[model samples]
Target: MTEETRRKAALVGAFERGAATYEQLGVDFFGPPGVELVHRAGVRSGQRVLDVGCGRGAVLVPAARAVGATGRVVGIDLAPTMVELTRAEVRAAGLSQVQVELGDAESPALPPGEFDVVLGGFVVFLLSDPAAALRGYRRLLCPDGRIGMTTFASQDPRFTEAMQMLVGYLPADRRRSPTSEHDALFATAESTAVLLRETGYRDVHVTDAAFESRFRDVEHWSAWIWSHGARSLLEQIPARRLPEALAEVTPVVERARAVAGDLVFTTTVRFAVAVSPG
Candidate 1:
């Protein structure tokens, strides 16, 4: 298989494996920022929207509401489980205008000149060819339509420290991120805006935003991290050593809380938007 094909498979595999936890932990935790991004893109009533990598209807549901019953919203994801979970939410919410389909970002089957807005939250950075994908998304918009995306500006410092502290528990060679098998993702606001302009978008702008995730204490923090992508780091420890590793990581969290609070984590993200020429 080609390198890009391999990269695409890895993205699907990682998210598919994390699908359950993502919906369980991510929907509520991530909803505000996702919704805020669509709002920044200026979604309105009677407009068609395309949410690329719509993980858990975080943005999809709000976009549907923004467009009201008169608009159409389609979400495409690389993981079937992710799309299915979001579709289930759509059904539960009675959003008949919202549809979820299984597809990759590299080639979302959306028709050109058909959508008024395309929003991708925490997704563009993961594409194997982000520039090419953005170029395609640009064509999907009608005259004067806009596209927006979100990327990590930085992780909460405590979380970053906690993660690093966890790495210290592992044996020497196995300490790197377990999720390294996936493609590299862009990680800053300025760089992302530059990419949008380079990919044929006009009037590009980047906005900085942050959201907080709280845990009652160290134990609560441990449980939450294991539920999502950070579980990759925990997987590096040997089965026998896992318990001991957790024991070691506990002190790190304790020290963090002393400096901060019982448990508060802040994730900073960048929301970048660019419009198609008329």
Candidate 2:
């Protein structure tokens, strides 16, 4: 398989493993940029919308609501589990206009010109061929339609430290943190804007927002880590050294919660939006 395809597959695997815990800890608990991104993309009533890398309807569900009964909202994700989870949520919420399909966010092959707003949540950087995918999204938008997506500007400081601590303990070959792979994607809003413009988007704009993710204490913090995709780090721990690793990581957690009675993990998120020249 091609290297880019393999990277996409690994990303799908990571999300599949974390699908069940994603909404609560990863989206709501950690603050997914769905609602914010939807608004930025101008998802108005009666509009047809597509959410790339929908991830349990973080953006899809809200966009469905924004579009109301007259509009349609479709979501695509690489993981079957995420697709099924989003479908279930849509059913439970009685949102008949919302549909979730299993597809590669990197190259969603959905029909073109059907959507007025194409939104993505935490999708751009993870894409195997982001520029190609942006062009694909451009083709999917109706004339005058716009596209928007969120990428991480930075992760919480404590979370980064605890993550580094875990990676620091692992063998050299296994020392990479999951998020380290996409650090350059949203490093600067100007860079993100340049990408949109280069991909044939006009009136491109980038905005930033800070979101706080909180944990009651270390117990809650550890649970959140293990329950999410970050558990990949925990899984890498040598079975023999697991206990030692946990013990060593405790101080890092303790220091993180030192000042705040509740540990607040704050991250800066960047949203890039632009219009299809049509």
Candidate 3:
């Protein structure tokens, strides 16, 4: 496999192992924002929708509900475990309009010109070939179909502070080559817009929103890290250095809580919506 493919495999495997905790954590981190974004997209009854990287069906379920009984929602993800979790949720929720499948966003296993709306949350940055993925999504849409995507606007200051401390404690090489840093992909809005334009999407709109979350204590931050795949960055480090890294991050977390007051951490998220011209 190519290096990019291998990295994606590792990333998907890590998320699969963390799926249960991810679902639990996602209820707070991703659920509400996803709903709000879809609502903003103004889905109507009988509009066909596709949810790319529909992890645990957070976005898909709501889209299905919005579309009513006449419409359909198809969710695609790279991880089999994610697909299973999404399917189980759909069954339990009794949402017949929603279905889940295992597939890559770069080359979704979907027929062209099928969907009226295509949406996903926090998935754009995760794609290895985001431009190619967007081009593929464009093909899957009907004439004048719209796409909505959500991603981090900038690293949350609190999260970045904690990460900086942890990296400081790691060996120099590991710190410099950290897996969690995707410097090339999500660094700026201009770059993201350029990518979307290059992929053939037009009338792109981007907006930023902030949310505040509270972690009871440092342990909560630690748990969040493990549950959100940040722990994978520590996997290659020597076991002896793990404690030191965690220790370094603890003070940063504590400082953030103090600055936040009531232990609330703030994150800034950006959403982009674009339409494919007929």
Candidate 4:
């Protein structure tokens, strides 16, 4: 399969597996940090908002509430399962103004110049062509619209260390040589700034926030990994080695927990916001 096809398959498989419990696990993992980023973006009533890569409506639902009944929120995700999950969530919440569609962030299949605001959480780094995606988003906005995105910052030593401990068990080819995915994309502020400027966004600002999360224990961490795409790595290991892999990673989890206490772990995220030229 082509690289693009492979990435799409991987994303589909990951979200499909996570969908059943995404609302709970996703909120537990990302809700607070994402909410803070959206809150900082200052979503107001009567604004039409577009949520790109709206995984399970984690950001879209809250954003709909923030925008009130007078506004509308549209959520789009590449994965059909993710879109379905988010749609169900919007229904369960009794939110009439929120809609979820299966669509690509790189080339959102929406009418031009409709949205007053675009919000993306932990999405920019995942796009194969982030600049092109931003350019597309710029066109979707109503000239003066603003975009807000959240991504990892600083490559938290604790998180990196945890991921590194798992690398040994993964297929050699699958091992990520880069320390962090975010670094692979926006390694420097200047690079990110340049990309934003080139994409025709102005008044760009990047800021940071940190939050803590707790797992009951190593078992909980293991479950989280298995449920969220780490299972692919486990599949590469021999059945006999699976237990060893889990055992080996237990200490890493313990270390992260000890370092972070009952919180289990702490991570700092960077949020970038830019305004489309009027």
Candidate 5:
């Protein structure tokens, strides 16, 4: 298989395995950003919306509410487990306007110009070809339809150090963090805005929001890591090395502990929005 195909397969497997705990951890990491993404996307009542990589319905749930009963919200994910669980959650929440499907966020299989808004909450950077995905999103939107997404401007320094420290425990051939591979496209607000504009989007706007998430302790912090895309990295280390890996990462993480003892990390997120020039 091609490199991109292999990368996508691995990502799907990681997310499928992490479906249960993804964002279900006690930390408030995804929710705040999800809500902020929807609000910034300007989802209007009665509009048709498409939420790409709608893991656990973080963006889906709020967009559904924002669009009201008259609107339609279709969420797509590559992992069947995420799609299945999110479907159940939508039903349980009685969001009749939302539909969850097992599909690819990179290039959803739908007709062109069918949606009024398209949202990618902390998921665009994970795509195998983010620029191509942006182009596809433009095709999926109605005239002047908007697209809004969030990408990390910077991770907490301690979190970065801890992750870097974990890299030492991985086998020699598999010592790279998956996130590091795609950091350039999302390296800065101007860079992302330039990407959108180059891909035919207009009126690009980029803003930053800093979110602070606190974990009860070291174990809580470790579980939080395993609960999301970060698990991809942790899972690569040999099972036998996990304890030693944790032992090494602990002190680095502890340095971020608050006075009350909760581990705190502030992530700077960049929110970018633009209009399709139909």
Candidate 6:
């Protein structure tokens, strides 16, 4: 398989393995950012929305609500489990206007110019070819349609240190985490905005916001990490070294403990919105 295909497959498999617990953990990690993405995209009633990498309906549900009954929302993800679970949630919520499907976020096989807005929440940097994906998303939009994506502007220092600490337990060949691998693409607001402009989008706007996620303690933090993409790194650490890894990461995270005893991390998320050229 081609390298990009291999990367996509690996991402699907990793997320499939964690789908059962993905975003199910009691943390406000994805929700706040997801909602903010929809709002920033200026989604409105009767508009069509496509949520790429719509994990657990985080962005899907809110976009659905924003569009209301007259509008339609389609959510696509590479992981079948993510699609299946998100569909179940959509059904449970009676969001008939929303549909979740198993499809690629990088290049969805849908007709061009069929959507009013496309939102990628914390999923752009994970793509094998983010620029290509952005260009494809622009093709999926109608003239003047907007696309909004969220990427990490900055992660908490404690969270960064703890992740690095965990990497020490990984085999030498696997020591680098995925976060480090994709950091450059969305490293700065200007860089990300330039990417959008280069990808044939116009009126690009990039903004940053801080969201606070809390964990009861180190154990809670562990569960939270395992439920999302961060699990990729944790999965690489040999099973025998899991305890050693966690033991070392705990103190680094504890350094962020709030006065009330909950471990708090303030993640700075960059939201970029741009309009499709006619």
Largest lDDT belongs to which candidate? 5
Every model's Cα RMSD, please? Answer: 3.2, 2.2, 2.5, 2.5, 1.0, 1.3
Residue lDDT tens for model 3, 1-278: 88776777767777777676774752267777688778877778999999998887768888998999999999988878888988997989899988898888878888899999999888867777677788888889999898888888766676887777666665676565424455565566776676677788888887788876667777776777766556556555578987877887777677766654545677777777888873
Give the candidate number with the greatest TM-score.
Answer: 5
* Total clashes in model 2, counting residue pairs 3 or more apart in sequence or in different chains: 0
Every candidate's lDDT: 0.78, 0.79, 0.77, 0.76, 0.90, 0.89
Off by over 4 Å in 1: 1-8, 26-28, 166-187, 232-237, 255-262
* Clash pairs detected, candidate 1: none
Clash pairs, candidate 5, are none
Show where candidate 4 strays beyond 4 Å: 177-184, 229-240, 258-263
Q: Model 3 scores what on Cα lDDT?
A: 0.77
Model 5, runs deviating above 4 Å: none
lDDT of 1: 0.78
| Candidate 2: worst-modelled 10 consecutive residues by lDDT | 23-32
Error in Å for residue 133 of model 3: 0.7
> Per-residue lDDT tens digits of candidate 6, residues 39-91?
99999999999999998988899999999999999999988999999999899
Better of 2 and 6 by lDDT: 6
Worst 10 residues of 3 by lDDT: 177-186
lDDT of 1 by residue, 20-115 (tens): 777464324567888899889999999999999988777898899999999999999988888988899899989999989987777787678999
lDDT of 4 at 93: 83
Please identify model 6 stretches exceeding 4 Å from their true place.
2-4, 179-182
Please report the TM-score between candidate 3 and the true structure: 0.90
